[model samples]
Target chain A: MLNPVIEMVDLTKKYRSFTAVDCLNLTVGKGEIFGLLGPNGAGKSTAILMMLGLTEPTSGMVSVCGINSTRNPIEVKRKVGYLPEEVGFYDNPTGMENLLYTARLNSIPESEAKKRAEELIERVGMAEAKHKKTGKYSRGMRQRLGLADVLIKKPEVIILDEPTSGIDPQGVRDFLQLIVSLKQEQGLTILFSSHNLHQVQQVCDRVGIFVKGKLQSVGDIESLSKQLFTESLCLIEAGIHEFPAENTDTKPVRKLLEPINGIAKIEHKKGVFEIECTSDLSATIAQTIVNAGYGLNFLNKKEYGLDEIYNRYFEGGIQHG
Target chain B: MKEGYNMVKKKVSEDTTGNQKKVKRPAKEKPKHPFWVIVNKEVSDHVRSWRFIILVALIALTCLGSMYTALNNMGDALKSSKTGELFFFLKLFTVSDNTLPPFFVFISFLGPLLGISLGFDTINSEQNRGTLSRVMAQPIYRDYILNAKFTASMIVISVLFFALGFLVMGLGLIAVGIPPTAEEFLRVIFFIVLSIFYVALWLNLSILFSVRIRQAATSALAGISVWLFFSIFFNMIVDLIAKGLAPSSFAPEYVIVKFQKMILNLMRISPAQLYSEATTTLLMPSVRSTGPLTMEQVAGAIPSPLPLGQSLLVVWPQVTGLIAVTILLFALAYVAFMRKEIRSS
Candidate 1:
């Protein structure tokens, strides 16, 4: 059995009467990219702060690399690298100077620090802007420099809070690719938080959906969809050029598809009939609709993506309360 | 999914093997202490800043202007009386004509400005720029940042004052053609050290405000307000209070004496009063005491200046009071900073 590199055991944080994080128990295995997906004000940032020991939890424990973070933060800090949301550096110093200062703070030797900074600068694709003042750099450039800043200490676990919040679409794609490469090439365990479900699905091995400071669901995308829907759903859309002499009549298609074992429901609107059923049933239903002498103009099966799964869970939560 | 699992397994094995070797190598090289690292970075940042340059230049220009005036008067005195042996070097710092106050007075007045300017933004600016959290995330204790900031700024202040002192001494030697005696040289050195401590008190106060106030501008304003109250209005307020307590002129001599003592103790609460009294005793040896002396006590005394040891005794309490206040302010700032929430943006 392999041990998790980063673990939170019933971690909780509260400010006055408001609980920001409520008994969060998370485990990130070695060499895993875990995306913490939630909307704004959902305790993602607070949880990251607690994990890095930058904030004292109201209760519970957080351990990084097997060291209790609250009890021994300095030891944990040495092994963990954190890139805060909208990370800022000393504006007056050049990018190289900023990285060198961070390296020195981590107690790396001067010569070695310089070499590592240069290597990281090139790796993050900021070699051209290494000598420029960080204040003059663009948001994308600053984010790249921030990535290099986190890697200078060669941390085993990296924590990023909303790393792609304000970046452009292309830059977000490029940045996510860079993060994936870092995990693969350097074998760093990464835990990043974001509100963008689609982006998280692109790079994360597993994701935890947070709602109102609670972990509503936690698993890979496929497993989460299974847990939410119980059975995979497929939708069949068929066009009807002619109705049965009535605008509200869906009887002909209903009569043909009602007896199918996995067909759950059928909805008719404006000349198109939609049929919902279990997996691989869309083809059989489409054949049935055509066999009943209706014009099957088009058929499509919609698999559940993270966006739909998130909406279902979040909406369910709202309606329940 | 199976492919991803296989890739992750391979990477983890590679990492464990590589981490073992890399960890062994770093263990051999002892890490530098966090104190020195913070000190080095802060020193470089302060020295290269435009604020330090402008402040140092202002002090230098004013000091030279006062020194020039003192030198002209000393030349005239040397020609007339030829009595420059007592504190020839000390005269360069303390002697002034009607054109200006002496160098000691100028420093005691403007020294707080240097301190407040250096420290008003030390912690708050870091917090506003969002660098405090990042720096605190490093492998260092929380208090190291505050302590290093004070130490680095103090080092800069000492260097500036010592350099200016030496420059004045060298110029005086060339202009007046007289070297200071051993006692005079020691007195000048002691004055410089005392001036550093006095300015450090203001620096610590400003840092305390910086920790308490969220905005750098507000902290700077608060620091200056304290300086202004002490420098300008505190003595007047103390006088009013003493008079209100003992208003009758026909009161007994003992009553008057007690009220006067109360007034003097009240004034000593201000660092400006303490610094000015200490420096006056050090630079002007003829001033034997700070309080009023009775006629009987003064009748038997000779009209000679006190020695360096006795002058030190006269000002020892003031010196210690300044130090105590400085430490108290610094301790308050340290506790406030250590307990502050790092994520409160």
Candidate 2:
């Protein structure tokens, strides 16, 4: 990492007999968007709480902005804005009032607190509803105010635990875009925790897959795919104009392509042929099919996305030891 | 040095606001102390709450009603009194018609409710609203929340007690056509102070329960249950125990006297007992002792009304007892709240 803003070293949190977060080691660099991806009960929230010093770890250390969270929680909290899962505000107070209360708690002077609150409410698209009581807001509206609340303190790092859990799909996209822009514009290091795989893939510069109170893997998508899927190699697909099995030429087309280097197996599905290979054999396979006078329409290589990786690792059990 | 963050944030906001800075105060004003900020917020929150309004109305109406009753019967009270009481101003609080209780009696009954109402939900309601953890995540220390809460409620209770006390004294001035002597004025002030501590005891108990119980309703119920236990059944239970160990009525006279003293000490464990004992001594000048005195001890005591200092000395133990229990319960709340996990669950 270029410059780690958040570092968790052997951090563990146990509740009597059961551990909520196991020994976890991870580092998120400056201005990086790191997604803490996990299932519902995978200790993602617990780890976030420990990082914000809202919960004490059973052992080891977690730090933010070079400050040990347990030892100097108030200082850590001052620099890191944490929006917990199912984040809530004082229901009786208007959204603006809640933000002001937070700003006051942070010791922001009255006039400055108001100015920041207004700008943030506008930034998070909560300007129209800022005057409304939070109890009357929908789930999506509450999330918007929550984001504004986090930004009011002008924190160096933002930790949002499941910020999009209850929002509509379009709102989630906009929220993700806002945070990414925030990272770019203000140079903020954001630690976003979510169970949403596709969304995490969309925004995070790197991802950490946590499972059953343990982190299974942490890296960018391409790096994680390369690290976890090297044994299975890659999948290649080719389409030819006359590729259906009803045509008697299909067998000849299949027999003609057996000489390609690194080709592992072939499966015919409808009109497309799936060529499994141990390497990037798209070039060789395309050349042979064209050389055999078969008009190929399309050829493509399959890359592992987060969903596929999650399914593979989750199904196989994350703990190999 | 960390406090400078607020100044930097102010500059950032000033840039954002441009020409819209409406505040006339100097931009370089120091940040208000966070502890006082929280206390102010809590006090205003309580004052605005519906429960607070209802409590004020309830206590105020009962106070006026009891004062009216006292004024209506004051002539007869002055005529029938053997000591020929001159401090009629004090009578507004102590003299009650058969149909109604005095100001002190109403305080003994309603003061606990006031404390319980203000504080039963102080912790759990914030936790339930999901604001506690969010507020705790701020730069303030953990204990600030609990301490600010206790201080704010104490402020409210004190203001309410002093306001009502002075209002009665003011009205008593108009009704009786004579101002209270300095000693009478001091006695009323002492009575208000004692009532405040009496309420403080219950406030601490309720705040303690608020920290221990997760549900606001359950904490409120727990506080009310304890209040009811002390005010009603606790004395009866003490009586039953005393009867069980009554020295058989055949033991030595000293043994019987010691047994009686033990039972009185046991009854004082109830906060209501302590409050009433302290209140009676503070409000009434002629009343001398909270505990029984022997013939020789009473014989030397003149029938004259005790001075303000002497009265306070008499009520000192009950006052100290009330304050000690209040502080002890507050300590329990403070420790529990500090150790509590800030997770929303």
Candidate 3:
């Protein structure tokens, strides 16, 4: 059992009367990519700030690599690499110079720092433009340089806040691929926050959904859907040529399905009927439909994706709040 | 199953301990202090900036102009044997003709500009450029950045002043054909140090404004406004207030003296006033005291120039007052900066 590399115990932050992050408890295991999914103003950035010890928490504790963040921020900072949302660099310095400054701040030896800076520049694919001042770089290039900047220190746990916020689809894909490759090559634990559901679903091993400063749920898509729905859904698309148009003609099918235990909802759309029931009731519903002489042309179970799960939890959170 | 679980647990514990050891291995080579890193960066940045160049050029040109005029006047005074020849080297800095004020007086008036120009945008520009939080995120304490900025700027200011002082001394030596005596050299050094301290007060004040105000232009305006109020209008305002309180003309002799003291005390609040008074006392040893002396107090005193030690004694309170205000302003700026949120806009 690997211990979690990052842990937050009942962390909370309040600005006057309004709470930014409510008593949140989170633990991220070693070498795992955890996604913090939320809409804008969902306390993800605030939580990241507290974890980095850049902002003081109103209450509770944060620890990185078993060291208390507030008690010894410099030690934790040494092990954590943060690529902030919309990252910026000194405009007057070249990309190489910027990285060298960061390297010097981390106290790497001058020769070693220069070597690593050159390697990182090439690795991040900015070698051709390494000598150009950063003010002239495009957004995509800047973000890539930002990644190189963070990697210069070789931190164990990397935290990126909205690393793909303003990039095009192709840029985002390339950037995320680089991130994943870094994780694989260095065995680094990554925690990235983004509101893009597709991106989160594509990269994260597990995810935590937050709404209104509250954690709605946390799990992989399958587990989250299982926990939320607590039942199975089977859609039977039948092309019945002799389908009855009157409501009275479907009474027998409705009666048969209503009598069965675990069957919750049955709705007819077009020539298909959707049956919501417990996991084991799908077979029974299919058998009864075919035995009733209805043309059961196609039947399939609908898999819930993260979008549906996120919407369900998001709406649930709003009502509960 | 139970045996397997125990074996896995033991392996995991060993792995974690091994990783911890690997992390600690680099601790043998200690890193440079973050303070010096920031200082080096800041000093280099300042030296390369156009603002420093322009200000240095401005000071140099004005000082040379004043030196030329003073040199001509000193030649005439030497030939006529009218002005006393003691501390003639020091006269290059303080002597004036019909055309220009002395070099020391020019510095007293323009020194605040150097301090303000360097510091007005120090913190605010970093914040605006979105570099403050990134720099703060490094493995260093929060106050290191602020301390480094102050220290680096002070060092630059000291270097600039000392260089200019030496230049003036060399020019004076070539023209006057006389080396400064030991007393004169020490007095000039003291005067230079005092000038640095005075400018530092303004530097700290502008830094305070920079930390509080987010816009670089606004902070610069605020710093200059305060300077103008002190340099241009503050004395007039103090005189008006003193007259309203004591009405020096209608009051008795002691009342008039009291009003005069009140005015002097009020003017001392300005760093510029304190600087000028202290420098005047240090460079012109003929000056005895800051306050006006009564007839009985001056009755038994000789009019001869005081020595270096007594001149320092005469200006010691003003010097301390300047230092106290500088520290106070710096403390305010430090507290404001440390408490400020390091969020990028």
Candidate 4:
């Protein structure tokens, strides 16, 4: 197995009594897309910053590609690409100029840096806007340019905070696709935090959920879904309310059935009863209802996407171990 | 399940052991970037700024306007005598070489403006834009950042001072039909050095202020406030103090001499005052009466204006003091900046 490319071992950061990042132990394998999900003040940013060695950890350690980050930050930086949320540019410079300067900072050779910059700008869909002065660029365009600048280095680890924030839906999709492609094509390890839960869900292989400066849970999407949220739901509509138990051995004739398993609860309102059950029971339960009832008007299993999963942690007040 | 757990433990150990044999990657081979890359960046950023260009142009116009007026009036005096015209233009153009001691008036008027313009936003803007953190994140030494800023400001101040020197010299040449003597050149150089120090004092103040105040606007305002107090209100306080402490003799000559001495001593407390005095002494060779004093009262009160070297020696303590103060301020800025927490946005 490949060694983890990024590691934070019991990393803690404290500012006075406020613990920004509390004993975070995280690892990113050589080619994993790891999402750090949290709301505001969850210390997602603080964790990434400590990992970058931009902020010193009060105690513990961070390493990038096996190099101790704190003791050798510049060396670690060489292998990392960072895109800060709300990125600021030398406003007077053009987009190309900003990219070139960042390339220089990363110690990329001038000729190679220029070529790489062009390629990144093209890849990030900023090729047409590259010549415009940064001050004149809109926020979305500036973000694209920022991403392009980070990609100019082709770093082994890419750490981005809210890479999709403030962007239109189309732009978000495009940016996520670009990140996915980078990971797939280059074997880049990504450690990105975003408020966009759906985007994280679609791309990330594993996620670390944070709340109130602590990691609430860390696992693959399926496990987190099963462990944290197992309430399967179904929407069913019936022509008659009579069933075998209610109608004295007279079952309402029905057809057009789908399968379900275990039904946990049923709520009837406006002639439609919503069924909630454990995982793998929705299809079996739905089929049972439709075959027994007179007319199955609607029978569909409900899939709670990332928005619900995100709220389960944020609103449920889960604590970190 | 037990076997899987054991396998996981073995993998963890293998990883930890692999970490133990950590091999240091060879430092990437990078060519030496010439010092000029940084210098060019600094110079281009500053010189291209609208603030710098507007400031230089406005100052030049103001100084030249006043000096032209002064010379025109002096030209009237020249109509009566050849000696008067020559003396008039010399006093007007060569501020540091005037017999009548006009250097104080010129420098006191110009020094603060030059100083504030050179340093008002040097550190604050970088901090606000978050570039300071990015620049420091590189492998370069900490001192390089501070020294580079100081050097860039110094270069700019040097360029402005010497450029003014050339402008005045050219005008003098056209008016007098003779270029400056070598001694005159030496005097100008001394004056320029004092001017640089004067600017450095402001830069130092601004840098310190920038660190203390998070906002660039606040730093600039604070710098201007310091300049205003020193240049405008300092002398008024000196006069009030002198009036309150007058001796019983009440002789105007003796009183004036005593007053002049008190004024000089009070001005010594302010760097701007020390700089203006230095410029005056460098320019004037016969400022025997520093105040409205009779010859008898000032019998030994005033010394003959010393040569350029002695004038420098005279002000060397003040210059050294200001430089020390500047370094101290810069050190404080460095410490403050280094300790600041740079959070990702």
Candidate 5:
């Protein structure tokens, strides 16, 4: 069994009467990108802060690298790199200078720190802005620089809270790609929180969905999809305003898709039709739609995107709570 | 397929192992990095800051200006054949035998401003820049952070005070054409301590206000208002109280006694007044002797006058109280800042 790098066993954080994180349990294994998917105010940042031991948990246990975070926060901090959602830095210091300072704070040797800073700066695509004062950097640029700062110690666990929250489209893409590269190249264990569903789904090996301070689901996206909706779904898009349209009994309907396998049921709404399957048949249906004379408006796997997952879990959690 | 499963299993283990590697070192022993790093950063930033520079420069300029003014008065007094003790003493201020040196006036007024400026924003700027939380997140204890700040500010204030003292001594040397005798030098050191204490008392007051009042502007205003009340308005109130409260049949001698008692009482509560009194005692030899004395000795008596032991006794309370209050205020700041949740966004 894989050992958990960061684990929270019924971790709870309360601000007075308001419970910000309620009995939250989570685990991110080594060398995997774990997406903490949540909407704003869903306690994602609170959980991240608790993992870093910046905020004390109201109850339960939090351990980073098997070291109890609350009992030994400084030890936990040394092992984890945290990039807060809104990254702030010393405005007077240059990007490189700030990273060097943070490296010193983390007790990295000066010579090795310089080398790592240079490496991470380039890795984060911040080499061009390395010498500029962080005060003058754009939001995306600041986030990139912040990531570079967090990596100064080459921390064993990287916890980034909404790392791409306010960046532009290209910036978000570049940021996600960098995280992917880090995961692949460094085997970095990352616990990332983001509202960007596509990016999280694309990069995360497993995801934990949080809503209203509650962890609603935690699994690989495929498993989560199946567990949440109880079947594999395919979004079938076609022209002529209906599915099984007028030719329901035709050979095309029967020969094209009926016998493939694992489809449990089908439903239609507006221009899109949903196919519930015992096994994923997204490719087969897309091919079938393409081969048929029907105009294939859109055909895609019905994985819950981050946005839809947030709406489903977050809104539902809010109502439930 | 088995190999693939094994690889995935190994990947997870590696991630956990990597985390374990980082946590092992710290759990085994306390990290020395956070304490040294914060102390170095605090000192370096303060040393390079504009406020520190301005503080030093202002002290130097004020010392030079006062020295020049003192020299001009000395020159005028010497030109007149009345090189008598009373003439020189009066010339130290109003060129009359009846008053205190104007230089003491400058010390009382200038010292508190320097003190207030040093402390009014020490905590506020860190909070404003959002670095306070980050600084606290380090492994070093919270008291160390406040200690470093207080130590850095005191170092700056001390440097300015001593530099100004030296500048005055140098100016006195050039004008009088003699290095201060050892006695005069001792007296001058005592007076400098007194002056610095006056400023430090205000500095401590400002620091306390800084902690109590969340806004830097408000803390500054509080420092200034207190300084103004003591420097300008207090004397008038003291005189009014003395006059109204004194018996109509009170003789001139009795009046002097009443006045002296009232003045000492007022100076006890106000550091600026204490500084002025101490400065008078150090600079004017006549005040030391408790009778009429010469003028050149007023500035001359500063360098070294009484025995070192006696000088220490003369200003011991001022020095001790100032430092005590400074420590007390910083303690308050430390407690408040530590209790404050860092989520002050």
Candidate 6:
């Protein structure tokens, strides 16, 4: 990642005997949206807190914007905006007032804070409801105001914990769309943690799956599938019907493909031969079949959705989540 | 009295003579103090809260009613005034009728309720609202939340007590047709300062409970229970202990006095006891001592009202104790809040 804005190297946090985040090592580059996907109590929130310098790690280090959060949390806080999983506001204050108060906490000048607050309120689609007390706001409205609240500080990196958990489907779509625009138009790096896989899949440029305090995989969809599916890829299909062959028997193709690496069993019918491999051997199988004087047809590697990927690596935590 | 807090560090104006000006000035300026936004927001919250409004109205009605009775009795006190009874204005605070307590007595009673009402849910309600972590994630110290709540509450207390004190004095001036002497004025200001410390003790106690308890109602209950334990039950407990370990009638008089002093010291453990003693000494001025004084100490003393300095000397331990206990409670709350896990509800 170029100019990584958020980095956690070997980060660990333990509460007495139970480890919350174990050896978390990840980097989020500038202007990137990194989603931390996990089940509840899977330590995603803990890692986010440590990244924001809100919770001290039991071991290792977390740095935000190149400032070691553990050593100088205040400096990190000045540049990083964190929206907790359950965003809260003072009940009596209007949404407008709440955003202004956050602006003040960040030491924004009075006029500047007001201007930024008004702009953000409008940008987050909260202009009509900004005058209403936050106590009367719906959960989704509060989440939107929470977005505006984090932006009032003009932060370089925005860390959101479950930004779309309790919203309706349409609201979630709008909120996720706003987050992407905020990153693209303003060049803000965004890191959000979510237990919902669909939300993570929709907006994240890259993702890390957390299971029981450990990161199982971290990459974009294709790369993550590549990392996860390469090991368990048991079936390989090679078609050889294009080239005319006098022999119409299965023994010829099976004999050609059986010598490939990681092949456990072979079955042949018509022009397609199925090779069962203990590990990924698609490349070697294609090369051997083509080199043995048979026209190599097509290679198959299973395309996976996040659900299948989630179920594959997070089988133990799936039901609980 | 940790006076120069970082957030409210008022470099607004250096005129120490005017209390109201100092109180009202910093709030109008550009927020130079970090988290002045929080202090300002919290102050407005307390002012707008119905709970705070009700408590202030209660204190106001009771103080005004007591002051009215004190006004009615001022004629008799004036006619029977002695040679050294120079504080005619001070009499309005201490002179009580059969039906009502004096002005100071009413304050001591309701001040704790006011403090607890403002602070019992200071931390827990914010946690329940899910704002604690969001605020703590800002570029400020964790102690800022607790300290700012405390500072704002203390500001309200000081403003209310001062306003009430000046209001009563202004009414007394209109009715009694006499202004307070300089000494009496200083004594009344000192009394208001003392009441701030008293209410501050309760405020810090309630904040401590808020930091430790997860539920707002539970923390409020815990604060009230402690107040009840100290105010009503403490004297009874001390009496029971005294009766259990009383020196016999056959014992030496010095031994009996020593035993009585021990019991008195035990009774002083309650904050109300210390506040009342300090109030009586400072407001009455004729109160020579707070404890049993031997003949030798009282041998050459004249039967006259002590000056403000001597009265302060008399209650120095109580005032210091109030300040000390208030700071100690604040420190305890600060440490608890800083170390607390930043979980939202």
Which parts of model 5 have CA positions greater than 4 angstroms off? A231-234, A240-301, A318-321, B1-40, B75-107, B135-139, B193-267, B282-308
For the candidates in turn, chain A alone yields TM-scores of 0.91, 0.94, 0.84, 0.88, 0.83, 0.78
When summed lDDT is taken over every stretch of 10 residues in candidate 4 chain B, the lowest stretch is B23-32
**Superposed Cα deviation of residue A250, candidate 3 (Å):** 11
The fraction of reference interface contacts (C-alpha pairs within 8 A across chains A and B) present in each candidate is 0.55, 0.70, 0.49, 0.15, 0.25, 0.70
The C-alpha RMSD of each candidate to the native structure, in angstroms, is 8.2, 5.3, 9.8, 12.0, 11.0, 8.4
lDDT of 1 by residue, A1-321 (tens): 186999998999999999999999989899999999998899998998888777889999999999989889999899998888878888989999999999989989877998999999999899999999998988888888888999999999998888887889998999999999999898999998999988899999999999888888789998887777755366676676665325687776788888999888888876667777776687788777777777767777777898888888666553322
Candidate 1 positional error at A305, Å: 2.5
Give the winner by DockQ: 4 or 5.
Answer: 5
Docking class of 3: acceptable
lDDT of 2 by residue, B149-246 (tens): 99999999999999999999999888888899998998998899888888988999999999999999999999999989988899889989988988
Please list the residue runs of candidate 3 whose C-alpha ends up more than 4 Å from where it truly belongs after superposition.
A231-302, A315-321, B1-31, B76-83, B246-250
Q: State the lDDT at B257 in candidate 5.
A: 61
lDDT (10s digit) by residue, model 1, range B1-345: 999999998997677685585775666466577788888888889899998899889889889989998887876655654444566567788777868888988898889999999999889888887688778878888888999999999999999999999998888888878888888888888999999999999999999999989999999999999999998899889978886897489988778877788888889888998998999999888788887676777898887888999999999999999999999999999999987876636
Cα lDDT tens digits, model 3, A121-160, are: 9998999999999989888998999899889999999998
Candidate achieving the largest DockQ: 2
DockQ winner, 1 or 5: 1
State the local distance difference test value for candidate 5: 0.71
Give the C-alpha miss distance for residue A196 in model 6, angstroms: 1.2
lDDT minimum window of 10 residues, candidate 1 chain B: B77-86
**lDDT against the true structure, each candidate:** 0.86, 0.88, 0.85, 0.70, 0.71, 0.86
Clashing pairs in 1: none
Clashes of each: 0, 0, 0, 12, 16, 0
DockQ for all candidate structures vs. native:
0.38, 0.62, 0.37, 0.14, 0.16, 0.53
Model 5 agreement with the true structure over A1-321: per-residue lDDT tens digits: 297998899999999998899999888889999998877788887787777776788899999899998888878877788776667777777989888878777776676778999988888888888989888989999888878877777788888878887789999888889889988888889998987788889899999887778888899887776565554444443332234444443444445666678766555545355666766677787777676766666665654555555665656543432
**Model 3 misses residue A25 by how many Å?**
0.9
TM-score of chain B of each: 0.86, 0.90, 0.88, 0.74, 0.71, 0.89
lDDT of model 6 at residue B264? Answer: 85
